[model samples]
Target chain A: MTGLLDAAFVLLILTTLVLLGSSRIRLGIRVLAVQGVVVGAAALLLPNHHVTLRVVVIVLIGTILDAVVFPILLLRALRTARVERETDPPVGYTASILIGVGLLTACLWGMKYGGITLPHEGANPLELPVAAYTVLAGLFLIVARNNALNQILGYLMLENGIFLAGLSTAMEVPLLIEMGILLDVFIMVMVMGVALFHISRTFDSIEVGGMTALTDWPDQEDVGK
Target chain B: MIAGLILIPLVAAGAAFAIRSHPVRRAMLVSVAAVHAALTARLWVDWPARPAPVLDGWLAVDAPGLLFLSTCSALFLAAAVYAVGYHAREDVGEPRRDIEEGGLFFRNEPEAVFAGCMLLFLGSMTGVSLSQHLGLLWVGVEATTLATAPLIYYHRHHRSLEATWKYLLICSVGLALAMIGNFALAASIPRAEAESGRINLVLGDLLANARALNPAWAQIAFVFFLVGYGTKMGLAPLHTWLPDAHSEAPSLVSALMSGALLNCAFLGVLRGHQVCTAAGFPGFSSELLIWFGLLSMAVAAVFILGQTDFKRMLAYSSVEHMGILALAVGCGAAYGMGLHALGHSLIKGSLFLTSGILLAAYQTKNVTKIHNLLADYPVTGLLWLAGFLAITGAPPFSLFLSEFTVGKTLLDADRPVAAAAYLVLLGVIFLGMASAVLPMVHGTGPVDHEPAGGQSAPPGYRPPLTMLVPPIVLAGAVLGLGLYLPVDVREVLRDAAAALSGGVSP
Candidate 1:
């Protein structure tokens, strides 16, 4: 079981990299769905945690939010916007992939050399670094993608990463907060979908870069200076 | 009573949604505001006789919480008055853009939704002020964002829509980071203590066990909490959404957002500082706070100088005052900081409300296109300049007294360099503010009185008395408190200050 957990953790991270590198929007969503399932399974595998009914329920809720509800929301937004691919990302695909790898490497290297350890003596080293990488990767997605749909995907990715880390590290995290966080994430994504539809309607596309009408430097002489 | 404070606004919000009549909904909004303000005042007066209870460690009202609660209610009540007046004028449908070529038409917003969300925002902010548990506090903070996002999109124009998107996405992201910070905080507790079932985010419990927390994780948690809440507070580099949100939202909403909402976020930061102080890491938090504070001030000064829109200018001014509030908190002069927060709120709230009047008169946000408020709308023009002066920390305003307290604290702490820098920043900000205000208030087109939507205002047109009174009342509060600090208000400040400094109010 421990071996499987280790493999699942690495696979979860591998899927995140795929999320970072993949240009097909559908493929990214599928990769994220797999990552979500793996994270849920891994939540059950955290060492020393009593697998109570509450934990099981939380895992179920989180899984549904991550793997099921989110992807549907993203797909609806994407279809409404009629965009199927993530193209002309702010950072190039190769560069974003490199950045993801760099973030993972930094987290691993910091864990080893930076004297970082959880307050709990037996806390597993694998979860924190992987979770950190996932977060950074999500941030990269949001920053690099100009499409509104893609940005929403990135935000969901970010929340998922936080959930994985929070659940694994903080045993005292009450069931109430876990449920609240899940609900907040779901509503946030739903709102983003509404906004994406509006964006598509208003700008004729869901491209975030098209939002140049409202800006600080409006005059031509110093528009961006 | 505490429950009533939270529930009243919420029930009003529900009723607001259910109501179909616009006047009825508007009346409900103001009535709720009045009741809230009254409750807060009663609570403030009765604090000593009947202290707030901590209910199962989930919710408690302490001195600082009451201070914040009162300020939120007071500022909100003033803004509520202005909102009713604002909608009255807005119903006249001023020209959406410049009064040329018949102008652009903005999409109509649902009045019920707007009214409902405003009340919901009030309830959520009240929740933030009273919440003692970290998770519940997080809920309130996030709810404030959710409630206020629609308020920002009230105009339903391209700009308001964009601002709404930014406000929602960015604040949600910031709050997600805060949740992770909370997780880190829980993780930092000693394993034995945590396992002993004393491992929650109840403010008192966390402070009690602060000594045993892992230093490394505690520092990590503090950083995330600061960055996360700081984003909401509109601190430098994290304030990207502020100007857009404030400028695009109705001026009344901007008033509440600046005067009332920012303080709630600042309370979250103060809670972060409280934990740091408890953990014997005051230096760490203080240094970061001061730096973020100065950086915010500097960034705001630059933007205010370049800013052309009057509402956006007020937004940047909000950023500057948030910085000063941060600086005061960092300086550990709890009394001074709380006072400064109050003063800034009174002055800033009035200023934003005044901005709404200016917008109504000129029908444009551009400072270049507006001139001679003294020549045109006399009351609003005079109030505009007065608010500008008051906000810039000029003498004869309450802001001067509070700002001075912070500067004295910095000097007493032997940070003369910081004190001097703070002063210099204030000067630069004043200059920047003056350049924008002088022309708007004193310069001479017989400034644009052609009300947008092709509504005509006669030459001697003045803003309605209801629209005029709220800001005048706020300005009086600012100037009055400057002249005389009542013993009652002073006592409240002292108790709240002590509470923030890790000493339970005596």
Candidate 2:
């Protein structure tokens, strides 16, 4: 069970990286959805001999929100905005992957220095490795993505990594906080959607670059009129 | 009583929203401000030590929380009064127009909704400052951001919309990161003690269990908390959204942001510092804060020097003062931090309010065009100029006394290097702000062309006694603090500072 969970973690990171390299917004969202599923499945594999029905319900809700609902919302927003190609990516694909590798290496170094050894008996050695990769991959998404929509994806990726970190002590967070977290993310996505719609209507583009025009030097015309 | 400070504005805001009559809505706002001020005054006089009501140890308030609550409540009352006059003038001067042909801009009606949201925003900020639990604090902070979003978009212009979007997106992301930090903090607590679900992440509990917290995880949490709250606090590197938001928002809202909102966020950092100190890592947190604070000062120096927009210049000045506040706290000077925080709150609040009046009078936010301000509006112009002087730490203002206190503390701590650095930064900021501000105050510039409609001022240009009173009162308070500190007030300041320093003798 632990081995499968560790493998799922690695898969999540790979999916995050793939999402970062993808120019198509739909594909990015799809990749994120897949990563979320892997995370949910990994959560299910945690050691829980005496899990209550309440816990089961919570895990189910969390998985459904992370895996199904969030991605659909992103997909809908992407389709509505018609933002298929990320023309002006913040960082190139190859450079981003390389940076991801460096980040993963640093994560391993950090974890090692902190002396965070897994205590769960029979857990695979790959647990730490997979965890490190997931976190760095999330960081990559955050740094490399230029579109505001994609940045949200990156944010979720980082969140997924943080969630994975808690697997060592799973079931610690209350169901309510977990729910609140999911609700917060949903609201954030909705607000971002509204902002994107407004931006597109005003600027004729949904690119994050459109925002750069906001801070332009004040024109005398504006002052005079 | 703390709950009342938050609830009164909230309930009044709802009432204002329901009432369509402009005059009634305006009256509601005034009454809410009056009631809030009265309650705050009561709290100030009593200085009651009511134990914070705990939700399973999720929230509580201590001394600092009470202090911030009082400060926020006081500022909110002042701004609420000012807003009534501001919106009334706006309504009389410029009626809503159909400007759809231009772009995605709409001339919003001057209805009660804006005033209502303004009060709600004020209430939410008060809630945040008084929150003892980390989770409640997070909710309060996030609520403030949401409440203020509508206020920023009040004008419904393309620029206002743009500013609102930036403010919302950046701050939402930052606050989300802070939430992640809160979770990490929960995760850092030891599980060996065996609670039912998760260990409650209250400040006091965290402080008590500091020794057992995972150091690495705690550090990660601090970083996120700092960045998240720091962004809201308008720290450098994360303050890109501040100037635009402050400049575009109504001047009354800008005053609240500069005067009140930034301090609320600073309280978040202070909470993190307390945790860090308890975790035996005071130096780490202090160093990080000082680094950001100094960086913010440097950023402000560059921007304020060449700033042409008067509002943006004031916004940058806010960044500079926030930097000084952080630096003073980081210096670990108990009295200095307490005095600086309170003094900055008063002076900066007055300055922003004065700036609002100037913006209304000149019908422009440009510094270059508005010259000989004293010639145009004597009382406001002189007050505006004095506000600038006071905010930049000139003598005969509360800020001067506070800055001097911080300087003395720095020197006494045997940190001449840090003291000198602070002095130099202060001097540079003063010079930069003076150069940008003095010209607008006294320089002779071309007269503004009257509107085609034959209005002498912009449609909403009336500066009523109500609009003028708050800043006058605040300015006098600043001057009074500078000239004399009452024995009781001095004692309170000492107590507050000592609280920050873990009850160390001042």
Best by lDDT: 1
Model 2, B100-166: lDDT tens digits are 1233325663567688888888788877876756767877788788778778877766677778877
Could you tell me every candidate's TM-score relative to the true structure?
A: 0.95, 0.89
- List pairs with backbone clashes in candidate 2: B59-B133, B60-B132, B60-B133, B93-B459
Q: Which stretches of candidate 1 lie over 4 Å from their true place?
A: A221-225, B50-54, B92-103, B445-461, B503-506
Output DockQ, candidate 1: 0.54
Task: Give the winner by DockQ.
Answer: 1
The number of the candidate with the highest TM-score is 1
lDDT of 1 by residue, B351-437 (tens): 988888877776668887776677667788889989999999998998998898899999999998889999999999999999989
| Candidate chain B TM-scores, in order | 0.94, 0.91
* Clash count in backbone of candidate 1: 4
Tens digits of per-residue lDDT, candidate 1, A54-144, equal 7888888888877998788777777777878867888988998899999999999988788877666556778788888888788889989
Write candidate 2's Cα lDDT for A1-225 as tens digits: 666766776787678668766777788778877887787677666653235675566557767767788887877777777778787787987777777767767766766676765434454555555655675576567656667777777767766665655554434545425634554664566566666676666656666555553452644333211
